[model samples]
Target: MRSTSSFFHFLIQKCNRKTRRKLKFSKELLVVDSTKIIVGIGQLPWAPLKGTRAGVKLNVAFHPSVGQPHRVIQSTGNHHDFRSSEELFDAAIINVADRAYAKCKRFDEYV
Candidate 1:
């Protein structure tokens, strides 16, 4: 447990330093979005879409300053974009999302 935490701490510092060299900002920013990947129904029977198709949704939390995704969540393509949002945001970080993730209830919760 201790080793894992230390490793992540080291990783964060490295990313922050790289980000600082590119852009200066007071708070960390996270860009959140989701995309659907279509597959043959036979490939993944669990994630069914329309006829003959199966799909999965990849929810990505990207750190533009670092030019990489900080977190990723996967679910059935039928899942709504907002479903993964609850886990994508941190109170200390400024999270930016598209219209699909904008929910009045979620905004209130964040406030």
Candidate 2:
């Protein structure tokens, strides 16, 4: 399992470097969204969503020009999507997200 994880980590780093090189001259734009993944309630007692279901959420920050996700954050399905925005957003880059992330305080802080 450790070897597999190492292999994937190296692969991802290689891909990210290549993508960065290709997009060096292009402007960076990040599109963010969250997707819920369902799991067995018995398998993961920690990720309870409702009475009978268990799941996890993946918050992804994607670089459309590079066709890859630059960042991913995982949380329990019950976690709010907007809460992950705080970690995904970079003050210098323009971030595009849906209404789920539209909190007035967060908007004002970015200004």
- The best candidate by TM-score is 1
Please provide, for model 2 over 1-111, each residue's C-alpha lDDT reduced to its tens digit, 9 standing for 90 to 100.
Answer: 468447544444554545757868344667777888898799789888887889999998876657788789999998898899888876665677888877999868867
All-Cα superposition RMSD per candidate:
9.6, 8.5
The clash tally of candidate 2 reads 0
Model 1 error, position 21 (Å): 12
Clashes per model (N, Cα, C within 3 A): 0, 0
How far is 11's C-alpha from truth in model 2 (Å)?
27
**What is the lDDT of every predicted structure here?**
0.81, 0.76
Clashing residue pairs in candidate 1 (N, C-alpha, C atoms within 3 angstroms): none
In angstroms, give how far residue 50 of model 1 lies from its true place: 1.1
Model 1's TM-score against the true structure: 0.72
Per-residue lDDT value at 4 in model 1: 48
Which residue runs of candidate 2 sit more than 4 Å off their true CA positions? 1-27
Q: What is the C-alpha local distance difference test score of candidate 2?
A: 0.76
- Position 101, candidate 1: lDDT: 84
TM-score of each: 0.72, 0.71
